[model samples]
Target: MNLLPAYVLLDLETTGATPARDRITEIALIRYENGEEVARWQTLVNPHMPIPPFIQTLTGIGDDMVQAAPDFESVAPRLYQYLDGAVLVAHNVRFDHGFLKHEFQRIGIILRQKVLCSVKLSRLLYPQHRSHGLDAVIQRHQIVVAARHRAMGDVEAVAAFIEAAGRELGEDRVALEVARLMTAPSLPPGLDPSLLDELPETAGVYLFFGADDAPLYIGKGVNLRSRVLAHFSGKTTDMAQAVRRVEWLETVGEFSALLLESHLIKTRQPLHNSLQRRQRQLCAWRLAAAPDIHPQAQLVREDAIDPTALGDLFGLYRSRKHAEEALRGIARNHALNPRLLGLESGDVRASSEPDAQHYLRLKLALAAQRLKDWPYPGKIAVREYDATSQRTQLHVFEHWCYLASVDNEADLHDVLAQRSTPVFDLDIYKLLQQVLLPPAKTGAKPAIGGLEIVHFQDGYDQQKTSSSSQ
Candidate 1:
């Protein structure tokens, strides 16, 4: 039996991994019909951009080689003819398909075809093998190639692997696997499949909208495409089916995605986002100042939160009742007086300790929840950069509040000039703590991994001073 009636074994060598930002430098494919090779095509297309040195080193196709070659637009029609009405076969087929769809889109041609992944085929055929990468398959099956990393070379390797699979694991079984792998992922009837192709595999926030442009859900992911596609995989859900439109905003990194996700969820109040909705009555415990004779703790509401006194704040609770419940739990566990904590009306004799000792014990119990003081003397901008897209985002923060994310110096200046008192957010505070706080054992300074920290002096006139990573 023929493994596939018609299929094209394809591969692409691109400038980088991201299809939305990077350009394809080369394309190669071999069309097969009835288990026989009918046509072979390969070309070096000018990407209209400089191929990075590392990519050139890997693919052995440099600027000079593609200088005279036709650009993707020039080769679009012929390439489409070769690809149309055939199952696109490749190792890690999504990577190749994503690039093809994007390139075709640039020329106003929507390229959509059934796909079969040889890597998945290898995994399904040889379940014991841990690695199904092309290199691993080539070495395991002893398939020789005229070249490697180059587009044509990788295509040949994948084609050889499929042919060998037909021989080793009966043609019937190979064909069965091909049929199973060709089954496309289901998409909502109202949603467009092309939208999934447009999603970049980068850090970003995505919003799903239902009928009448009502928001169904809002979420963030490092790979927006993979995460969004996962919703349609396996068992379908009501939210996935209700989704009629999809929108996304790409970010420089995961931190920015997170901040945006939190902000959007609270503001938009999507139908499916139950947990991240705005906590209007959010409250926290503010410890009393030293030598004060007032209550040891006071419940402060969200609007009343003082950014300057964030260091004196404790656990962020959902409401007044939650705050009281938490303090009661701390008082019971630490054997402190409830009257001293302002939790009850009458004095209860939990312990005969002095007021200062009781306060000390309460403070000790709440130490883990106590907010950290802002390490910087002034506002600081956490700079996140993406090398692939050449994008930069400066996330400005005061205390634990996220002020704004700016891309240009002029915008940054504007943000500084229009500085207002930053409001403390529970979600932003938690995110910043997780990213900026150092480990307890190390006793090191707070630092964001792989990000630059810049300090602003006093006003818009103050120049940005870069500090060592902290």
Candidate 2:
């Protein structure tokens, strides 16, 4: 590609795919500027750890090869010089770049650079081409490779492909593609592109901020970078226009992301997020009237929704109107007295007929069997593991109540010691029902997965200790 801007065609052989845990075994790059290759560099790095046998077989670089080679710390300065101002290029560049970043960061070095993926470039440039790996590119361009899995060999193949593209498609076309690949499209006015580069391609929560860094919307995804960019990469809407800045927090896995997203959305009540607001005022309909009295349905707020005290609750609704409307629909279908359910304004005395009693029985029978109660005896902690981070968090729940979450035992004790009122959230109930309950038996809700459910009775140890002391 004819360019004043330099590009470092890079490749790395690593111990494993993960950047955080794996070590780089080899490094190589071909530096180019103004359509000419100025220099090429390759080095075997001593990982200070044993390389797996499978890795050795794949790259043909054994322990003996790297025994005398310099480690990454020794080669950092020179490698940084080659990468400092250039657009980093590699097949699946994120993998190589993520590995190098972790390596550099360990020694107190921050490596941030614009990255272009040759694999993506190939896919974009040659839409008809299926595979864009080094071997595929080598075969496609009729370029012979001296080494197959070696770092320099892969770099050479990538360089040759660029050269071929420039020759066949013209220098201007090649440069245009390079420039396009390097930059993100139609980012919000003042929001920097470098911010996008800062995001990791891992599970995380992302927040969009408007004028004063006020959270506009918060969302979670398995891949943060792609999902975040997908927002601005499309046609600029009100969300795109309003987003002046962005922030993100990376999690170990999807489960952690899910928990954090739910928690934040419930607490923060971000302006743009309408679905899962604080739900502090969540309410449900509970049949409260006796047979002699008119059949009455009352709204039970979260704080007062103690299932032990208040039995036989009906539809969970977000607002009073919604609850009334639901009751109205149920009454109409059963031809129960609308005045009794507080749906239509009328005299309750107008419904003393035996038909009214029959309709009330019909309504209760229709809504009776499915008023679900807490299946668990007491407080339960569902342990969730983040495999990438190897972190475990205990999600403490009681009677379908999310009391608190703790990452360690001490914090878990503290969470258990503190007594918070069981706020019966409609969303939480539905979510837990869908996940924790059985679908075949309930037939009313979906069963998501089999979770590790543990039951802990509150203050049991204290009560036993007091009895023994007496």
Candidate 3:
């Protein structure tokens, strides 16, 4: 007889795949120690979200069945306690683990444990077998699974498979294979052991810190945990060694993650985030007062931009020097006068008269890149919704400048009542490319993370006039 290490056979029934957009309907786990069953637990989790019709039919966990069940918050504490210091075993552990982590992430809890996927275990132990899913395992071993898709039934099936494997091919061989599958990630000694469990696989911004809590690096990823883990997998640089701790903030999608990362890097000026030096003063050149004889380019500071009300704007640059360099390059390429572009303050004399003709064409070519003024006459809102988390955020914008993000219509009123000038961000301008631009400009259909455009045009003229006069 071989003594098996403490482990929990686990299974979950979720509303759907893609953990970011789905909810766990149920959880079942059977704990075993020294090759004997020690404890067993199961629960119907109130996802606080709707269970799709297909999921209900497939899993037989209808909305009505889970209506009065305790939400994950109510059960998280006990569930966390139950899995402590035990390896998590499941048919396809990633699927189960993903749902568990995502659910815990919503309520700001970290669920981390060594995971052993029995599906993988089956393949490893029985190399001759091509099919390793629970159904295949059950069919091959002739084990009874009373309930097919239900969590407890599936968990029991997994436990049975392990037992059969131990008897058929020596417990020692099974235990060694289980140990290999249960390997945990090796993390930095300075970081907490539990931190890896909390780092969500969802889109988010991650920050790394060094000694004295200095911002070492700021990064964004769709799968935050994998990206953060890859950085520490090998001792490649000082970055791996200098890091003390890691922190992350979750976003609904990649668009939000990238925007948040850029904003933090610019604002925090992390020592390791080495791209932009003059990111703090984002600026651009705008073709002011369309078609005047003196078609001069005006410097539009981000602090004063109303993107929705803007005219032809060009090349969002972080510094005055880069903006000037770009304008000069454009002038040189198009044979336009640099003086008219505000790169120089010299007069347009008789000899330089020919360059003015070139300036007119330059304005037209540059118009294509111009920021679209708020097409609607007034303020409008762009919405971003997370299908899985069921979280919605409405970003209010005026003249292309983002004003505020509100959760509900009632909150929209509060955001509008406060008179605030919309500031432009180069980072946001680029981030908006993911959603705001149509196929022609971005060269693809923009997926705005469920962005719904809403117009708030009533009494718009008055506000525009008031802000402009000021």
> Residue 191 of candidate 3: its Cα lDDT?
82
Going through the candidates in the order shown, the clash numbers are 0, 0, 7
RMSD of 2: 7.8
User: Which candidate comes out best when scored by TM-score?
Assistant: 1
Alpha-carbon lDDT, every model: 0.82, 0.74, 0.73
Better of 1 and 2 by lDDT: 1
lDDT of 2 by residue, 350-460 (tens): 776664465566456446534577765566665555544455566777777678877765676777777777756665665666555432333232232223444566553
lDDT of 3 by residue, 185-238 (tens): 677778887775556656788999998899999998977977888887756467
By TM-score, how accurate is candidate 1?
0.82
> Candidate 3: which stretches are off by over 4 Å?
1-6, 12-27, 30-85, 91-112, 117-149, 156-185, 274-281, 287-306, 339-347, 350-356, 416-418, 437-445, 448-451, 456-470
Candidate 1 residue 429 C-alpha distance from true site, Å: 1.9
C-alpha positional error of residue 409 in candidate 2 after TM-score superposition, expressed in Å: 11
Give one digit per residue, the lDDT tens place, for model 1 in 175-269. 88888876657998998877744666678999999988988899999879778888999999999999999999988877788889999998899
Question: Model 2 segments beyond 4 Å from truth?
Answer: 1-5, 15-22, 34-37, 48-67, 106-109, 122-150, 153-179, 188-193, 210-213, 233-245, 307-311, 344-349, 352-399, 403-423, 430-470
The global Cα lDDT (0 to 1) of model 3 is 0.73
Ranking by TM-score: 1, 2, 3
